[model samples]
Target: MTSRFTELVVDCHDPEGLADFWCRVLDFKVIDRGEGKVEIGSWVPTVEEVRARQMPPTLLFLQVPEGKTVRKNRLHLDVSPVDRSTQDEVTRLLGLGATTADVGQDPDASWVVMADPEGNEFCVLRTLAPQE
Candidate 1:
């Protein structure tokens, strides 16, 4: 028996805005929506191929009155660019409303800590070759 990730449910004040932001960041698309939630799924062929056994996990943004807190999140996402350099990707993300974030990490760390428009923290990992 094996288990595969199917969805990542995120609580947010504006499901529409978060979905838009993540869609651009991940090259995803808004595929579904409900009364209080929006689901974003992948459009990348490689990503879909990697999850051939089933569909890849969708980023599900659900409605929440209280948004992110002042304290850091217990869990955060780490992303790697498939084709572009890490610095370029980070710069593009910054242009898309992402901001550099600090969470007490050593300055020499490889990953770039960043926060979304809603202040959720995620890391931009080292870039990977397209073949990777």
Candidate 2:
């Protein structure tokens, strides 16, 4: 049997806060919360959907003592706008607390680097459905 990608866990100081930020960014909703963990994803799937392996991977924010000490992220996510232009999405993210981060990309790079509230870097790519 082959394994399917499921979830991505992130270490942060405030799980709920980070989850909230990501939920707004990704248009996801909080699905679960525990002592120090907050799980967010697209709306919960039915059992059949889960069995069919059709669920998008969820993000679980875990609280950690030594949170985000690194200067840069070793692994980052790249997101594309679903219904809006990349520049509009970047503006929306900035309004939601994401800050522009410079990881020494060339001026003509196709992606924009931005950091979440906990300083995790992610890139915003072109819109998913390009205008015709």
Candidate 3:
């Protein structure tokens, strides 16, 4: 059996603000909201709680008192464009407030390093494999 990904949770100081930033970046929407917690998801709501609970759940941004740090990231996401060129997608993400991070990749490499608004690192790659 294979497991399906329900969501990716990010810990941050400002949950709502971070959720808004990611929603804009990924075209995701807020599915659930609670005190110091915000969930954003890519899929539309299904059940009553998901629909009426007033919280987003695609990706959750949890509020933490400490500032964000990148000493190490156990998990990171790599995004790619559907039809647009990689260069174009990188430019678009940059415009959306993502900043470049120097990860020591060759200049000619197809993937570009970027950090989210909360300083979490991710990548925008040149290619995406076909969906199963």
Candidate 4:
């Protein structure tokens, strides 16, 4: 058997803020909360695992020292709106403080690459049919 991919984790100085931003972006919820950690997941886990058996399968938002620069994102999320045009979504995100990034995409293209408030780059692609 081979290992499967799991959740993506992000390190941030403001855990609550990042978690809230991601919740807004993905329409997900803050499934778990702690003093210095927060978790966001697409779906809630139903099974309870004991001790080391638990997989801890959720995107972790860890608190770090203030004024920390994000050297590289160990993981990033690409977001696209479900029922809105990509242009509209990009506009909305920009209004929400996301800015353009240097992804080498022409300005006329259907997809726009943007960085979140913390400078994490994510792509907003033109709408395609949802995968089954």
lDDT of 2 by residue, 2-80 (tens): 4556689999999999999999998899999999999999877566666677578899999999967778789999999
> Which prediction has the highest TM-score against the true structure?
2
Tens-place lDDT per residue, model 4, 1-132, is 334344567767888887887777777788988999999977676543322254535677888776545554545567767877787888888877789887566778767888888788888987653545
TM-scores of the models, in the given order? 0.85, 0.90, 0.77, 0.74
Cα TM-score of candidate 4: 0.74
User: What ranking of all candidate models by lDDT puts the best one first?
Assistant: 2, 1, 3, 4
Report the alpha-carbon TM-score of model 3 versus the true structure: 0.77
**Runs with alpha carbons beyond 4 Å of true place in candidate 3:** 1-4, 45-57, 127-132
The clash numbers for all candidates, in the given order, read 0, 0, 10, 0
lDDT of 3 by residue, 1-132 (tens): 333345678889889888888888778888889999999887765665554554433688899888756554668888887757777888888888899887666888779888888888888887454444
- Candidate order by TM-score, decreasing, is 2, 1, 3, 4
Worst 10 residues of 4 by lDDT: 47-56
Question: Which residues of candidate 1, in runs, are more than 4 Å off?
Answer: 1-3, 43-54, 130-132
> 13 in model 3: Cα distance from truth in Å?
1.2
Q: Candidate 2, which segments miss by more than 4 Å at Cα?
A: 45-51, 130-132
TM-score of candidate 2 relative to the true fold:
0.90
